[model samples]
Target: MNTHRTAHRLVSRAATAAALATALGLGAVHTATASAPSAAPLSVRPAAPGPDGGWHQNGLHLTAAENKKVNGFVARARRAERAISPGVRAAARISHAELVGFDQRLKSPDSLKRKVATWMLESPGQTVDASLRKINDAVRFTLQWPAGTYSQGVRTAAGLLSAWGNDSTRWANTWNRPTGYKAINSAWRAPRSGQLFEVQFHTPESKAAQLETHKLYEEQRLPGTPPERVRELQEQQDAIFAAVPVPPGAERLTAPARRLPSPDPARRLPAPAPAPVG
Candidate 1:
Protein backbone atom coordinates (compact mmCIF):
# COMPACT_ATOMS: atom_id res chain seq x y z
CA MET A 1 0.00 0.00 0.00
CA ASN A 2 1.14 3.56 -0.67
CA THR A 3 1.61 4.85 2.86
CA HIS A 4 1.59 8.51 1.85
CA ARG A 5 -1.52 8.13 -0.27
CA THR A 6 -3.24 6.16 2.46
CA ALA A 7 -2.40 8.81 5.02
CA HIS A 8 -3.77 11.58 2.82
CA ARG A 9 -6.92 9.61 2.14
CA LEU A 10 -7.47 8.97 5.82
CA VAL A 11 -7.14 12.66 6.58
CA SER A 12 -9.52 13.60 3.79
CA ARG A 13 -12.08 11.04 4.91
CA ALA A 14 -11.88 12.26 8.48
CA ALA A 15 -12.48 15.85 7.35
CA THR A 16 -15.39 14.83 5.15
CA ALA A 17 -17.00 12.91 8.00
CA ALA A 18 -16.89 16.00 10.21
CA ALA A 19 -18.28 18.20 7.44
CA LEU A 20 -21.19 15.83 6.93
CA ALA A 21 -22.02 15.95 10.61
CA THR A 22 -21.99 19.74 10.56
CA ALA A 23 -24.13 19.88 7.43
CA LEU A 24 -26.69 17.72 9.19
CA GLY A 25 -26.55 20.16 12.13
CA LEU A 26 -25.89 17.17 14.34
CA GLY A 27 -23.67 19.34 16.53
CA ALA A 28 -26.30 22.00 17.09
CA VAL A 29 -28.18 20.13 19.74
CA HIS A 30 -28.41 16.97 21.80
CA THR A 31 -30.35 14.00 20.43
CA ALA A 32 -34.03 14.83 20.34
CA THR A 33 -37.09 12.65 20.88
CA ALA A 34 -39.77 12.04 18.27
CA SER A 35 -42.14 14.40 20.02
CA ALA A 36 -39.65 17.17 20.72
CA PRO A 37 -40.30 20.57 19.22
CA SER A 38 -38.94 21.04 15.72
CA ALA A 39 -35.63 22.84 15.45
CA ALA A 40 -35.76 26.58 14.93
CA PRO A 41 -34.75 27.65 11.45
CA LEU A 42 -31.18 28.91 11.02
CA SER A 43 -30.78 32.66 10.90
CA VAL A 44 -30.58 34.09 7.42
CA ARG A 45 -28.14 36.77 8.47
CA PRO A 46 -25.29 36.80 6.01
CA ALA A 47 -21.80 35.68 7.04
CA ALA A 48 -19.24 38.38 7.67
CA PRO A 49 -17.76 39.59 4.42
CA GLY A 50 -14.22 38.50 3.67
CA PRO A 51 -11.35 40.66 2.33
CA ASP A 52 -12.47 39.73 -1.18
CA GLY A 53 -15.98 41.05 -0.51
CA GLY A 54 -17.46 37.56 -0.57
CA TRP A 55 -18.38 35.09 2.13
CA HIS A 56 -15.35 32.98 3.05
CA GLN A 57 -17.44 29.91 3.72
CA ASN A 58 -17.36 27.97 0.47
CA GLY A 59 -19.34 24.73 0.60
CA LEU A 60 -22.87 23.42 0.16
CA HIS A 61 -24.85 25.77 2.34
CA LEU A 62 -27.77 24.03 3.99
CA THR A 63 -31.28 25.47 3.97
CA ALA A 64 -33.58 25.71 6.96
CA ALA A 65 -35.72 22.80 5.75
CA GLU A 66 -32.62 20.73 5.15
CA ASN A 67 -31.39 21.48 8.65
CA LYS A 68 -34.75 20.38 10.00
CA LYS A 69 -34.51 17.16 8.03
CA VAL A 70 -31.01 16.60 9.41
CA ASN A 71 -32.29 17.13 12.92
CA GLY A 72 -34.89 14.44 12.34
CA PHE A 73 -32.26 12.11 10.97
CA VAL A 74 -30.03 12.56 14.03
CA ALA A 75 -32.94 11.79 16.32
CA ARG A 76 -33.74 8.58 14.48
CA ALA A 77 -30.07 7.62 14.45
CA ARG A 78 -29.87 7.91 18.24
CA ARG A 79 -32.79 5.52 18.62
CA ALA A 80 -31.21 3.05 16.22
CA GLU A 81 -27.93 3.24 18.14
CA ARG A 82 -29.66 2.19 21.34
CA ALA A 83 -30.97 -0.91 19.58
CA ILE A 84 -27.54 -1.83 18.21
CA SER A 85 -25.31 -1.04 21.19
CA PRO A 86 -25.68 -4.43 22.84
CA GLY A 87 -24.37 -6.44 19.92
CA VAL A 88 -21.54 -4.00 19.26
CA ARG A 89 -20.50 -3.96 22.91
CA ALA A 90 -20.56 -7.73 23.10
CA ALA A 91 -18.42 -8.00 20.00
CA ALA A 92 -15.98 -5.40 21.37
CA ARG A 93 -15.66 -7.30 24.64
CA ILE A 94 -14.89 -10.50 22.79
CA SER A 95 -12.40 -8.69 20.58
CA HIS A 96 -10.42 -7.35 23.52
CA ALA A 97 -11.09 -10.00 26.12
CA GLU A 98 -7.60 -9.66 27.53
CA LEU A 99 -7.54 -5.86 27.61
CA VAL A 100 -8.75 -4.18 30.80
CA GLY A 101 -8.99 -0.60 29.45
CA PHE A 102 -11.03 0.88 26.60
CA ASP A 103 -13.42 3.68 25.80
CA GLN A 104 -16.51 3.93 23.63
CA ARG A 105 -18.60 6.88 22.56
CA LEU A 106 -20.88 8.32 19.92
CA LYS A 107 -19.52 11.37 18.11
CA SER A 108 -20.96 14.54 19.50
CA PRO A 109 -22.74 17.07 17.31
CA ASP A 110 -20.39 19.90 18.31
CA SER A 111 -17.22 18.06 17.28
CA LEU A 112 -18.77 17.01 14.02
CA LYS A 113 -19.67 20.60 13.20
CA ARG A 114 -16.12 21.77 13.79
CA LYS A 115 -14.72 19.13 11.51
CA VAL A 116 -17.29 19.97 8.83
CA ALA A 117 -16.44 23.64 9.05
CA THR A 118 -12.74 22.94 8.74
CA TRP A 119 -13.22 20.73 5.69
CA MET A 120 -15.54 23.21 4.03
CA LEU A 121 -12.96 25.95 4.48
CA GLU A 122 -10.13 23.82 3.14
CA SER A 123 -11.92 22.14 0.24
CA PRO A 124 -14.24 24.77 -1.11
CA GLY A 125 -15.63 22.94 -4.11
CA GLN A 126 -16.52 19.62 -2.51
CA THR A 127 -20.12 18.84 -1.65
CA VAL A 128 -20.68 17.11 1.66
CA ASP A 129 -23.93 15.48 0.47
CA ALA A 130 -22.42 12.16 -0.52
CA SER A 131 -20.33 12.08 2.63
CA LEU A 132 -23.46 12.80 4.64
CA ARG A 133 -25.21 9.84 3.02
CA LYS A 134 -23.00 7.52 5.06
CA ILE A 135 -22.01 8.95 8.42
CA ASN A 136 -19.82 6.27 10.08
CA ASP A 137 -18.32 7.55 13.30
CA ALA A 138 -21.72 8.41 14.73
CA VAL A 139 -20.86 5.42 16.89
CA ARG A 140 -17.30 4.35 17.68
CA PHE A 141 -15.13 2.66 20.32
CA THR A 142 -11.46 2.87 21.25
CA LEU A 143 -9.48 -0.03 22.68
CA GLN A 144 -6.61 0.65 25.07
CA TRP A 145 -4.00 -2.04 25.54
CA PRO A 146 -0.32 -2.37 26.35
CA ALA A 147 2.07 -1.44 23.55
CA GLY A 148 3.11 -5.05 23.13
CA THR A 149 -0.49 -6.24 22.76
CA TYR A 150 -1.60 -3.52 20.35
CA SER A 151 -1.35 -5.66 17.27
CA GLN A 152 -3.11 -8.66 18.75
CA GLY A 153 -5.85 -6.53 20.27
CA VAL A 154 -6.64 -4.60 17.09
CA ARG A 155 -6.59 -7.70 14.89
CA THR A 156 -8.98 -9.53 17.17
CA ALA A 157 -11.33 -6.54 17.22
CA ALA A 158 -11.33 -6.25 13.44
CA GLY A 159 -12.04 -9.95 13.03
CA LEU A 160 -14.99 -9.78 15.41
CA LEU A 161 -16.47 -6.76 13.64
CA SER A 162 -15.97 -8.36 10.25
CA ALA A 163 -17.92 -11.37 11.43
CA TRP A 164 -20.62 -9.24 12.98
CA GLY A 165 -21.65 -6.89 10.16
CA ASN A 166 -18.71 -5.03 8.58
CA ASP A 167 -19.13 -4.54 4.83
CA SER A 168 -15.84 -5.81 3.47
CA THR A 169 -16.01 -3.51 0.48
CA ARG A 170 -16.02 -0.49 2.79
CA TRP A 171 -13.49 -1.64 5.34
CA ALA A 172 -10.43 0.53 6.02
CA ASN A 173 -7.61 -0.21 8.43
CA THR A 174 -5.26 2.77 8.32
CA TRP A 175 -2.16 3.12 10.47
CA ASN A 176 -0.35 6.43 10.85
CA ARG A 177 3.04 5.35 12.08
CA PRO A 178 4.20 8.94 12.04
CA THR A 179 1.47 9.98 14.45
CA GLY A 180 0.97 6.62 16.08
CA TYR A 181 -2.69 6.86 15.10
CA LYS A 182 -3.85 3.44 14.07
CA ALA A 183 -7.46 2.48 13.60
CA ILE A 184 -9.47 -0.37 12.18
CA ASN A 185 -12.30 1.63 10.73
CA SER A 186 -15.22 0.04 8.91
CA ALA A 187 -18.82 0.52 7.87
CA TRP A 188 -21.33 -1.83 9.45
CA ARG A 189 -24.41 -2.01 7.24
CA ALA A 190 -27.37 -3.16 9.25
CA PRO A 191 -29.57 -5.46 7.19
CA ARG A 192 -32.78 -3.86 8.34
CA SER A 193 -32.06 -0.11 8.10
CA GLY A 194 -29.38 -0.32 5.46
CA GLN A 195 -27.69 2.57 7.25
CA LEU A 196 -23.94 2.32 7.77
CA PHE A 197 -22.42 3.06 11.16
CA GLU A 198 -18.67 3.23 11.79
CA VAL A 199 -16.53 1.26 14.25
CA GLN A 200 -12.93 2.22 15.14
CA PHE A 201 -10.33 0.19 17.01
CA HIS A 202 -7.27 1.87 18.49
CA THR A 203 -4.45 1.15 20.90
CA PRO A 204 -4.12 3.25 24.07
CA GLU A 205 -0.92 5.04 23.12
CA SER A 206 -2.26 5.78 19.69
CA LYS A 207 -5.47 7.11 21.18
CA ALA A 208 -3.54 9.49 23.41
CA ALA A 209 -1.48 10.70 20.48
CA GLN A 210 -4.62 11.25 18.45
CA LEU A 211 -6.10 13.43 21.19
CA GLU A 212 -2.89 15.41 21.52
CA THR A 213 -2.62 16.04 17.79
CA HIS A 214 -6.24 17.04 17.46
CA LYS A 215 -5.67 20.59 18.59
CA LEU A 216 -2.73 21.01 16.28
CA TYR A 217 -4.78 19.68 13.39
CA GLU A 218 -7.49 22.17 14.21
CA GLU A 219 -5.01 25.05 14.28
CA GLN A 220 -3.63 23.96 10.94
CA ARG A 221 -7.11 24.24 9.53
CA LEU A 222 -7.47 27.89 10.34
CA PRO A 223 -7.81 30.28 7.40
CA GLY A 224 -4.51 32.11 7.78
CA THR A 225 -2.17 29.68 9.47
CA PRO A 226 1.46 30.08 8.40
CA PRO A 227 2.92 27.24 6.39
CA GLU A 228 5.87 27.08 8.74
CA ARG A 229 3.58 26.66 11.72
CA VAL A 230 1.73 23.86 9.95
CA ARG A 231 5.00 22.06 9.32
CA GLU A 232 6.04 22.55 12.91
CA LEU A 233 2.78 21.06 14.16
CA GLN A 234 3.23 18.06 11.88
CA GLU A 235 6.78 17.55 13.11
CA GLN A 236 5.61 17.57 16.68
CA GLN A 237 3.04 14.92 15.89
CA ASP A 238 5.61 12.85 14.01
CA ALA A 239 7.97 12.96 16.97
CA ILE A 240 5.21 11.74 19.26
CA PHE A 241 4.26 8.89 16.93
CA ALA A 242 7.90 7.99 16.32
CA ALA A 243 8.25 7.05 19.97
CA VAL A 244 5.35 4.59 19.95
CA PRO A 245 6.62 1.06 19.52
CA VAL A 246 4.96 -1.00 16.83
CA PRO A 247 3.81 -4.31 18.25
CA PRO A 248 4.53 -7.61 16.57
CA GLY A 249 2.32 -8.50 13.60
CA ALA A 250 0.78 -4.98 13.49
CA GLU A 251 2.29 -4.10 10.13
CA ARG A 252 0.44 -7.02 8.54
CA LEU A 253 -3.05 -6.43 9.95
CA THR A 254 -5.75 -6.73 7.32
CA ALA A 255 -9.56 -6.97 7.31
CA PRO A 256 -10.40 -9.91 5.09
CA ALA A 257 -14.10 -10.39 4.42
CA ARG A 258 -15.92 -12.89 6.58
CA ARG A 259 -19.34 -14.44 6.15
CA LEU A 260 -21.55 -14.21 9.21
CA PRO A 261 -23.96 -17.01 10.12
CA SER A 262 -27.23 -16.72 8.24
CA PRO A 263 -29.52 -18.05 10.92
CA ASP A 264 -28.78 -15.45 13.62
CA PRO A 265 -29.04 -11.99 12.12
CA ALA A 266 -30.38 -10.56 15.36
CA ARG A 267 -27.06 -11.20 17.01
CA ARG A 268 -25.86 -8.00 15.31
CA LEU A 269 -27.05 -4.50 15.90
CA PRO A 270 -29.69 -2.81 13.77
CA ALA A 271 -28.35 -0.77 10.86
CA PRO A 272 -28.76 3.03 10.63
CA ALA A 273 -31.42 4.60 8.45
CA PRO A 274 -30.44 7.04 5.71
CA ALA A 275 -30.68 10.68 6.76
CA PRO A 276 -33.78 12.36 5.38
CA VAL A 277 -33.62 15.62 3.44
CA GLY A 278 -36.58 17.96 3.35
Candidate 2:
Protein backbone atom coordinates (compact mmCIF):
# COMPACT_ATOMS: atom_id res chain seq x y z
CA MET A 1 0.00 0.00 0.00
CA ASN A 2 2.71 2.49 -0.68
CA THR A 3 0.58 5.33 0.71
CA HIS A 4 1.94 7.83 -1.76
CA ARG A 5 1.22 5.62 -4.71
CA THR A 6 -2.19 4.73 -3.36
CA ALA A 7 -2.98 8.36 -2.79
CA HIS A 8 -1.85 9.26 -6.27
CA ARG A 9 -4.04 6.62 -7.85
CA LEU A 10 -7.07 7.49 -5.71
CA VAL A 11 -6.72 11.16 -6.44
CA SER A 12 -6.26 10.47 -10.12
CA ARG A 13 -9.49 8.50 -10.14
CA ALA A 14 -11.28 11.25 -8.28
CA ALA A 15 -10.10 13.80 -10.82
CA THR A 16 -11.12 11.52 -13.64
CA ALA A 17 -14.60 11.09 -12.17
CA ALA A 18 -15.05 14.83 -11.89
CA ALA A 19 -13.85 15.32 -15.45
CA LEU A 20 -16.15 12.61 -16.75
CA ALA A 21 -19.20 14.04 -15.03
CA THR A 22 -18.44 17.47 -16.42
CA ALA A 23 -17.92 16.10 -19.92
CA LEU A 24 -21.23 14.27 -19.73
CA GLY A 25 -22.95 17.54 -18.79
CA LEU A 26 -23.87 16.09 -15.46
CA GLY A 27 -22.59 19.04 -13.52
CA ALA A 28 -24.51 22.22 -12.79
CA VAL A 29 -27.08 22.62 -15.52
CA HIS A 30 -27.42 26.41 -15.63
CA THR A 31 -29.66 26.81 -18.64
CA ALA A 32 -32.61 24.73 -19.74
CA THR A 33 -31.58 25.10 -23.37
CA ALA A 34 -28.05 23.78 -22.91
CA SER A 35 -27.48 20.26 -24.28
CA ALA A 36 -24.59 17.81 -24.08
CA PRO A 37 -23.51 15.25 -26.65
CA SER A 38 -24.72 11.70 -26.20
CA ALA A 39 -22.46 8.70 -25.84
CA ALA A 40 -22.84 4.98 -25.23
CA PRO A 41 -24.45 4.32 -21.89
CA LEU A 42 -22.36 3.01 -19.02
CA SER A 43 -23.38 -0.54 -18.11
CA VAL A 44 -25.53 -0.53 -14.99
CA ARG A 45 -25.30 -4.27 -14.49
CA PRO A 46 -21.91 -5.71 -13.60
CA ALA A 47 -20.39 -8.23 -15.99
CA ALA A 48 -16.62 -8.58 -16.13
CA PRO A 49 -15.27 -7.85 -19.60
CA GLY A 50 -12.32 -9.79 -21.03
CA PRO A 51 -8.82 -8.37 -21.56
CA ASP A 52 -8.75 -8.01 -25.31
CA GLY A 53 -8.31 -5.16 -27.72
CA GLY A 54 -8.66 -1.99 -25.56
CA TRP A 55 -10.95 -3.41 -22.87
CA HIS A 56 -9.85 -5.16 -19.69
CA GLN A 57 -11.77 -6.45 -16.69
CA ASN A 58 -8.73 -7.55 -14.74
CA GLY A 59 -9.89 -5.55 -11.72
CA LEU A 60 -11.96 -7.07 -8.93
CA HIS A 61 -15.58 -7.83 -9.60
CA LEU A 62 -17.81 -7.43 -6.57
CA THR A 63 -19.83 -10.35 -5.33
CA ALA A 64 -23.58 -9.91 -5.04
CA ALA A 65 -23.32 -9.67 -1.26
CA GLU A 66 -20.52 -7.09 -1.45
CA ASN A 67 -22.51 -5.03 -3.91
CA LYS A 68 -25.52 -5.04 -1.57
CA LYS A 69 -23.41 -3.84 1.35
CA VAL A 70 -21.78 -1.08 -0.72
CA ASN A 71 -25.17 0.05 -2.02
CA GLY A 72 -26.51 0.35 1.52
CA PHE A 73 -23.46 2.37 2.56
CA VAL A 74 -23.90 4.70 -0.41
CA ALA A 75 -27.54 5.34 0.45
CA ARG A 76 -26.60 6.38 3.96
CA ALA A 77 -23.82 8.62 2.64
CA ARG A 78 -26.26 10.42 0.35
CA ARG A 79 -28.53 11.16 3.28
CA ALA A 80 -25.56 12.69 5.06
CA GLU A 81 -24.79 14.81 2.04
CA ARG A 82 -28.33 16.10 1.87
CA ALA A 83 -28.26 16.93 5.58
CA ILE A 84 -25.13 19.07 5.13
CA SER A 85 -26.05 20.84 1.91
CA PRO A 86 -27.75 23.82 3.54
CA GLY A 87 -24.74 24.76 5.62
CA VAL A 88 -22.42 24.33 2.63
CA ARG A 89 -24.62 26.47 0.42
CA ALA A 90 -24.84 29.23 3.00
CA ALA A 91 -21.10 29.21 3.53
CA ALA A 92 -20.45 29.42 -0.21
CA ARG A 93 -22.86 32.31 -0.52
CA ILE A 94 -21.05 34.21 2.20
CA SER A 95 -17.80 33.58 0.38
CA HIS A 96 -19.16 35.24 -2.78
CA ALA A 97 -19.71 32.07 -4.74
CA GLU A 98 -20.08 32.45 -8.48
CA LEU A 99 -21.27 28.93 -9.24
CA VAL A 100 -21.62 25.71 -7.29
CA GLY A 101 -22.29 22.08 -8.19
CA PHE A 102 -23.47 19.57 -5.65
CA ASP A 103 -23.61 15.90 -6.55
CA GLN A 104 -23.69 12.56 -4.76
CA ARG A 105 -23.54 9.24 -6.59
CA LEU A 106 -22.47 5.75 -5.75
CA LYS A 107 -19.77 4.57 -8.10
CA SER A 108 -21.59 1.99 -10.18
CA PRO A 109 -20.90 -1.53 -8.97
CA ASP A 110 -18.91 -2.14 -12.13
CA SER A 111 -16.65 0.86 -11.48
CA LEU A 112 -16.08 0.05 -7.84
CA LYS A 113 -15.28 -3.57 -8.57
CA ARG A 114 -12.81 -2.50 -11.26
CA LYS A 115 -11.07 -0.13 -8.82
CA VAL A 116 -10.94 -2.80 -6.13
CA ALA A 117 -9.32 -5.18 -8.59
CA THR A 118 -6.75 -2.57 -9.52
CA TRP A 119 -5.97 -1.99 -5.85
CA MET A 120 -5.60 -5.70 -5.28
CA LEU A 121 -3.03 -5.90 -8.09
CA GLU A 122 -1.23 -2.83 -6.77
CA SER A 123 -1.22 -4.14 -3.20
CA PRO A 124 -1.94 -7.82 -2.99
CA GLY A 125 -3.53 -9.38 0.12
CA GLN A 126 -5.80 -6.43 0.87
CA THR A 127 -9.12 -7.96 1.96
CA VAL A 128 -12.60 -6.74 1.09
CA ASP A 129 -12.78 -5.08 4.54
CA ALA A 130 -9.62 -3.11 3.85
CA SER A 131 -10.88 -2.14 0.41
CA LEU A 132 -14.26 -1.00 1.74
CA ARG A 133 -12.57 1.08 4.44
CA LYS A 134 -10.66 2.97 1.74
CA ILE A 135 -13.76 3.65 -0.32
CA ASN A 136 -14.25 7.25 0.88
CA ASP A 137 -15.84 8.96 -2.10
CA ALA A 138 -19.17 7.17 -2.42
CA VAL A 139 -20.77 10.54 -1.87
CA ARG A 140 -18.87 13.29 -3.68
CA PHE A 141 -19.28 16.91 -4.81
CA THR A 142 -17.58 19.83 -6.56
CA LEU A 143 -17.72 23.58 -5.85
CA GLN A 144 -16.63 26.37 -8.16
CA TRP A 145 -16.26 30.11 -7.79
CA PRO A 146 -14.82 33.04 -9.75
CA ALA A 147 -11.07 32.83 -10.48
CA GLY A 148 -9.67 35.30 -7.94
CA THR A 149 -11.99 34.26 -5.11
CA TYR A 150 -11.05 30.60 -4.90
CA SER A 151 -8.96 30.96 -1.76
CA GLN A 152 -11.67 32.76 0.13
CA GLY A 153 -14.24 30.23 -0.98
CA VAL A 154 -12.17 27.29 0.19
CA ARG A 155 -11.32 28.91 3.51
CA THR A 156 -14.94 29.77 4.21
CA ALA A 157 -16.16 26.30 3.32
CA ALA A 158 -13.50 24.64 5.46
CA GLY A 159 -14.26 26.88 8.38
CA LEU A 160 -17.99 26.29 8.17
CA LEU A 161 -17.52 22.54 7.81
CA SER A 162 -15.18 22.48 10.79
CA ALA A 163 -17.76 24.29 12.87
CA TRP A 164 -20.54 22.02 11.62
CA GLY A 165 -19.14 18.58 12.43
CA ASN A 166 -15.97 16.49 12.51
CA ASP A 167 -13.65 17.60 9.71
CA SER A 168 -11.13 14.90 8.74
CA THR A 169 -8.41 17.34 7.85
CA ARG A 170 -5.73 14.72 8.38
CA TRP A 171 -7.30 12.57 5.67
CA ALA A 172 -7.96 15.50 3.36
CA ASN A 173 -5.91 15.81 0.16
CA THR A 174 -5.28 18.48 -2.43
CA TRP A 175 -4.10 18.22 -6.08
CA ASN A 176 -3.20 21.78 -7.05
CA ARG A 177 0.23 20.84 -8.35
CA PRO A 178 -1.30 19.64 -11.59
CA THR A 179 -1.22 22.14 -14.44
CA GLY A 180 -4.53 23.56 -15.78
CA TYR A 181 -6.53 21.87 -13.03
CA LYS A 182 -6.34 22.92 -9.38
CA ALA A 183 -8.57 21.36 -6.72
CA ILE A 184 -8.80 20.96 -2.96
CA ASN A 185 -10.01 17.48 -2.08
CA SER A 186 -11.21 16.93 1.45
CA ALA A 187 -13.25 14.37 3.35
CA TRP A 188 -15.58 14.53 6.34
CA ARG A 189 -17.24 11.99 8.54
CA ALA A 190 -21.01 12.12 8.36
CA PRO A 191 -22.42 12.78 11.82
CA ARG A 192 -24.88 9.91 11.96
CA SER A 193 -23.21 7.11 10.01
CA GLY A 194 -19.60 8.34 10.19
CA GLN A 195 -19.28 7.40 6.54
CA LEU A 196 -16.65 9.47 4.74
CA PHE A 197 -17.50 11.59 1.69
CA GLU A 198 -15.36 13.84 -0.51
CA VAL A 199 -15.71 17.49 -1.46
CA GLN A 200 -13.81 19.17 -4.30
CA PHE A 201 -13.27 22.90 -4.71
CA HIS A 202 -12.22 24.41 -8.04
CA THR A 203 -12.32 27.58 -10.07
CA PRO A 204 -14.48 28.00 -13.17
CA GLU A 205 -11.60 27.87 -15.64
CA SER A 206 -10.08 24.80 -14.02
CA LYS A 207 -13.46 23.03 -14.05
CA ALA A 208 -13.86 23.77 -17.74
CA ALA A 209 -10.41 22.35 -18.46
CA GLN A 210 -11.36 19.23 -16.50
CA LEU A 211 -14.40 18.80 -18.76
CA GLU A 212 -12.23 19.26 -21.86
CA THR A 213 -9.76 16.57 -20.78
CA HIS A 214 -12.36 13.95 -19.79
CA LYS A 215 -12.37 12.17 -23.16
CA LEU A 216 -8.60 11.84 -23.22
CA TYR A 217 -8.59 10.46 -19.71
CA GLU A 218 -11.22 7.87 -20.67
CA GLU A 219 -9.20 6.83 -23.72
CA GLN A 220 -6.09 6.35 -21.64
CA ARG A 221 -7.96 3.95 -19.39
CA LEU A 222 -8.58 1.49 -22.22
CA PRO A 223 -6.90 -1.73 -21.10
CA GLY A 224 -4.95 -2.31 -24.30
CA THR A 225 -3.81 1.26 -24.97
CA PRO A 226 -0.12 1.27 -25.84
CA PRO A 227 2.12 2.89 -23.26
CA GLU A 228 3.18 5.48 -25.83
CA ARG A 229 -0.42 6.24 -26.69
CA VAL A 230 -1.22 6.72 -23.03
CA ARG A 231 1.66 9.13 -22.76
CA GLU A 232 0.36 11.01 -25.79
CA LEU A 233 -3.09 11.27 -24.19
CA GLN A 234 -1.58 12.66 -21.00
CA GLU A 235 0.47 15.19 -22.96
CA GLN A 236 -2.62 16.30 -24.81
CA GLN A 237 -4.45 16.79 -21.49
CA ASP A 238 -1.47 18.70 -20.09
CA ALA A 239 -1.51 21.05 -23.07
CA ILE A 240 -5.16 21.90 -22.54
CA PHE A 241 -4.64 22.41 -18.82
CA ALA A 242 -1.56 24.56 -19.42
CA ALA A 243 -3.69 27.11 -21.20
CA VAL A 244 -5.99 27.63 -18.19
CA PRO A 245 -4.87 30.82 -16.45
CA VAL A 246 -4.61 30.77 -12.67
CA PRO A 247 -5.93 33.98 -11.24
CA PRO A 248 -4.18 35.92 -8.50
CA GLY A 249 -5.00 34.62 -4.97
CA ALA A 250 -5.95 31.21 -6.36
CA GLU A 251 -2.41 29.86 -5.85
CA ARG A 252 -2.48 30.69 -2.15
CA LEU A 253 -5.30 28.29 -1.31
CA THR A 254 -3.52 25.48 0.55
CA ALA A 255 -4.73 22.18 1.94
CA PRO A 256 -4.73 22.05 5.72
CA ALA A 257 -1.57 20.75 7.39
CA ARG A 258 -2.06 17.28 8.82
CA ARG A 259 -0.04 14.12 8.94
CA LEU A 260 -1.55 11.25 6.97
CA PRO A 261 -1.58 7.83 8.60
CA SER A 262 1.19 5.47 7.57
CA PRO A 263 0.42 2.77 5.03
CA ASP A 264 -0.30 -0.71 6.38
CA PRO A 265 3.11 -2.37 6.59
CA ALA A 266 1.61 -5.68 5.47
CA ARG A 267 0.44 -4.09 2.28
CA ARG A 268 3.35 -1.76 1.59
CA LEU A 269 5.08 -1.73 -1.79
CA PRO A 270 8.52 -0.45 -2.64
CA ALA A 271 8.43 3.27 -3.30
CA PRO A 272 9.51 4.27 -6.78
CA ALA A 273 11.63 7.31 -7.53
CA PRO A 274 9.77 10.43 -8.51
CA ALA A 275 9.25 10.95 -12.23
CA PRO A 276 11.03 13.98 -13.68
CA VAL A 277 8.92 16.89 -14.92
CA GLY A 278 9.90 18.21 -18.32
**Model 1 residue 20 CA deviation in Å:** 38
Alpha-carbon runs more than 4 Å astray in model 2:
1-60, 103-109, 170-180, 256-278
Q: In candidate 1, which residue pairs get closer than 3 Å at backbone N, Cα or C atoms, i.e. clash? A: 18-116, 19-116, 27-109, 195-272
Model 2 lDDT tens row, 181-243: 455667776555576776677777777888889889877775557899999998988898887
- TM-score for model 2? 0.63
lDDT by residue for model 1 (14-58), tens? 334333443444321111111111221222112333354332233
How many clashes would you count in candidate 2?
2
Candidate 1 backbone clash number: 4
